[model samples]
Target: MNLALHSVSYAGVWPGQERLSLEEFIPRAAALGFKGVMLVAKRPHLSLLDYPSHQPEKRQALRALLAEHDLSVHSLAGYNDFTVGPERPDVPFWEHQIVYIAELAALAHDLDCPAIRIFTGYNRDGLSYDAGWTSVVTGLQEAARLVADFGVVLTVQNHHDIAVDYESMYQLLSEVDHPNCRAAFDAWSPAVQGLHGNELAAAVRRMAPFTAYTTVADYVALPRYRYEPALVNYVEEPARMLGVPLGEGLIDYGTFFDTLIETGYTGTVAYEMCSSLRDGGNLDSLDAYARQFQDYMSPYVAKANAGVAAATAR
Candidate 1:
């Protein structure tokens, strides 16, 4: 399986430092042996918000940038309709969201990205769980329909709140019930929602036919202190981010990789971390930070390859 870097690790870095352009990040990721970058296609970076659609000049510029650094776009984060937190669905806004997804679909097609990432959203306040779930599914289905003609797949991430559990995820995917609709499984969400590990693994296998991508990271429960340690202290008040350093984190990397092998997953295995996005992580030094990340991941990948070799020998 290929390994890729998701730009979310550098979530708060400004335009000048990390990933405002391919030049800022591609070479660094390449040197660390990452296969590609999960470009979010957002503002101040690619300014994807303003990129002229289907424009020849812009397409040529993008292609040239990728070629310059021996890199390619893995998938755009395209975080649309993700956390529509517990609000009753708006018919008009929902229709507008469809148009937004269609534009993103067109852009994905132009960039040659095979899949788009979406998030199963939240329950509307005071709305019954049944109605909220139905609306979320219908919204995603509309996005699915727009991209089906181009053979592009929509891979939804298992963020909690909306997709709070494995069973809930199954329900969402069932609603969108199309082959091109699929899962982008995050390692810890199933466990967060209290599913048995085996059951969670089984849920992944069920998504196998439709799982286009898989994101990996370990989570650590907070130390029982009065207040949390500062991961992004520079933010003055940071969000309660839990995971850090591949093996050091709570999620089991070794077991998770074993599961990936069992499922025969061959797509990109992406490294996603939000802890290092802060002011003092020294990540912009590039080689230092990315190499540290590579070091953490290298052994896991090697172990996986050895397992494959052993199986092939049989």
Candidate 2:
């Protein structure tokens, strides 16, 4: 249960976010007591274009900086939408993604990272479910084989439309059938889908074997209202969400972490503020929220570690 902060929090993609360069981000995370960090493999951080494997000078410099702060690259986050247009036979979208993953795998290897986070493709309209599922399975298998050479694992996060739930994710990993393919299972998706209590724990427990790491964030839903002029009434719109501190949101991380730890999960648990947060996304607010997550997660993480220590001692 190593606590890590995702660099995306300081990437400033969200409005009003106070951003930090990678140089500034590493030390800040160390100061916040993060044992490791999940570096986003995009611009405003470790861009694959900028830190290619050929650039040993840049990679070595980054490695030196990480060592200076006693921080590890727990994982590298790669953004890939594996779903491609079924109509465009001329397009090389799937091949392009495989190459992109290879590049990131090399980058991760240079930084001594063991895993990289990725996504299953969305189930886009106009494509058959079978086709999309097959594409994702094939893509992941290829990516796994490519990265296996570097001893890097591709941990698929449950964030997209395809293979999003526990059963589907487990099936996808099995079909991929590569030892380097694993899961970056998160509670957010299952919780949002109304899985809680023992149901949630069961899902976590089932996915534990393939789970390489887990990313954590919480959110509370805010219902929306729409004015209806004809009826002279307000209609209830679907609820939108804003991010909150770990335990304050509707997500039941207690059961989530407890199940993972019980199943012998000792990988990094990362915190990310990928959306508009409860407080403003300004620098002070972001820092406060990040620290709060660390505080809330520390005890659970400590308990897990203690259990591990006792077991090892025995």
Candidate 3:
């Protein structure tokens, strides 16, 4: 139950957020009392272009930088969609993504990170659900094989449209059937889907065995409406979710963490403010949000660790 902060929170991926380079971000994360960090493996951070597999020096430098702050890299977050270019079969998009992940795997190995977080494909128009599912399963199998030699595990997050639900994610991992492929489950998606109390606990327990990692973020839903001039009324639209500080939003991390611990999940729990936050995403706001996660989760992590220690003593 080690706590880590995601670099995306300060990478300015979302509008209004102030960005920080990996060099600057490391010290700040350490200062915020994180045991490790989950780095976004792209531009303004650890992009493959900047730290290519051929460039061992860059990887070593980054590793030394993290060590300088006495911090570890919990995981490297990668972006890929297995079903991209469904219409352009000749483009070899899946192969390209596989190679991209392979490179990230190499980078992770050099950085001493154990896992890399990736996503299944989003549903494409004209593509059957079964087709998308098969593409993701096979793609993950190949990616897992590619990274196996590097000793890096590929963690498929319960994100993207292919297998977002906990049940589907479990099925996806089972079908992939690779030793290196595992789950990177998160609380945000299940919370948004209206899972709470017993239901949320069930989902966590089901995924716990396969889950190698998880990320935490809190959000409040903002209801939307569309004006229908012809009817002279407002039509209800889907709600927009805005990120908030931990414990202040719709997510029930209390239940989430309790289940995780009960199921013997000793994996990293990363906090990320990956979207437009409630307050403006200035440096101050970002720092405060990151600190809030530390303040909130400290007790939970402490309790989990104490339980483990007590069990070992027995």
Q: Of the candidates shown, which would achieve the greatest TM-score relative to the real structure?
A: 3
Per-model CA lDDT versus the true structure? 0.66, 0.91, 0.92
User: What's the CA error at residue 78 for candidate 3, in Å?
Assistant: 0.7
lDDT string for model 1 (1-314, tens) is 66778776555453323432545666666766776777665654444556667475786677677777777676777666633544444546666666766776777777677777777666556767676677678888888988887778888888746765666787778877987778887767665555445766676666666677877665556533343357533323322445455666555556556677777766777776645432234454433445556787676677667777887899
**Model 3 global lDDT (CA atoms, 0 to 1):** 0.92
Q: TM-scores, in order shown? A: 0.80, 0.97, 0.98
Q: Give the candidate order by descending TM-score.
A: 3, 2, 1
Of candidate 3, the 10-residue stretch with the lowest lDDT total is: 50-59
**TM-score between model 1 and native:** 0.80
lDDT of 2 at 257: 89
Greater TM-score among 1 and 2 belongs to: 2
Off by over 4 Å in 3: none
| RMSD (Å) of each candidate, 1 decimal | 5.5, 1.2, 0.9
Q: Flag regions of model 1 displaced more than 4 Å.
A: 13-22, 82-91, 194-200, 224-239, 276-280, 284-289, 299-314
Give lDDT tens digits, candidate 3, residues 227-285: 99999999999999998899999999999998999988888999998999999899889
| Residue pairs of candidate 1 with colliding backbone atoms | 86-123, 86-124, 86-125, 87-124
